[model samples]
Target: MLPAIVLSVTIARPWREVYEAFWRPEAFPRWASGLSDMALRPDGDSWVGEGPDGAIRVFFTGHNDLGVMDHRVIPDGGAPVHVPLRIIANGEGAEVQLTLFRQPDMDDEMFARDRRWVRKDLATLKALAERG
Candidate 1:
């Protein structure tokens, strides 16, 4: 089993506010600037992202399951690591949990670096929720 490091934060914001912002794909570009741009298109029964990641085209899948599937998609070898997170409300503030899975033979340093990115991104999300 892959070990998952769970991180959480509490804010004085209502769950509804955060939930709406997260579900609407149109609002993603404003806060998460990692992607230059993104759009939601139908794929079978899912919404996938086809956007510009600087020079390369980034193809990503969106998960609407279990707490909005609050996550991002980055191309292989493009971004250090892309983790889809589950953002839920814990009392007053929202709780964002990132579950990291160990891909076979993946380098430790790479996972570490990806973990760092995920942390920063989560922090950014928290700040946005507080500000918005």
Candidate 2:
């Protein structure tokens, strides 16, 4: 099993509203900098976008009543990396959680950097959700 870390942020918004606000493929680039460098365009059942290393194809969970926002990212000529994300109720607000998995080839420093990137992105998402 790969090493993993779950990072989360609490946003001052309803869970369902928060899920609806950012569940679309086009909405990802607004905050998930670690995932896509720009807007993702629909391509068949997935979305394609320019990622940090190069091009990437992402498949997101279909819209549902549950707050599941899981996605799989496949870099150019690379294996798919599953990213599990969820938005659940936390009192009157929402708690967003994202799981970051440390790839088998990743070193400590690389994993740390990815962790920090996810934290920053989550913070950005929190700010956007609160203000929207």
lDDT tens digits by residue: candidate 2, 1-132: 998999999999999999999998889899999678888999999999999999999999999898999999999999999999999999999999999999988999999999999999999999999999
Q: Put down candidate 1 lDDT per residue, 12-121, tens digits, no spaces.
A: 57766676666565555555455435555544443345444443233333545446554445443555344555667778777767676655556888678657765676
In model 1, what lDDT does residue 7 have? 56
Which segments of model 2 are wrong by more than 4 Å?
none
Q: In candidate 2, what residue range of length 10 has the lowest lDDT sum?
A: 34-43
TM-score of 2: 0.98
List the candidates' TM-scores in order. Answer: 0.62, 0.98
Error of 2 at 104 (Å): 0.5
RMSD of each: 4.7, 0.7
Candidate 2 has an lDDT of: 0.94
Best by TM-score: 2
lDDT of 1 at 63: 40
Q: Count the clashes in each prediction.
A: 3, 0
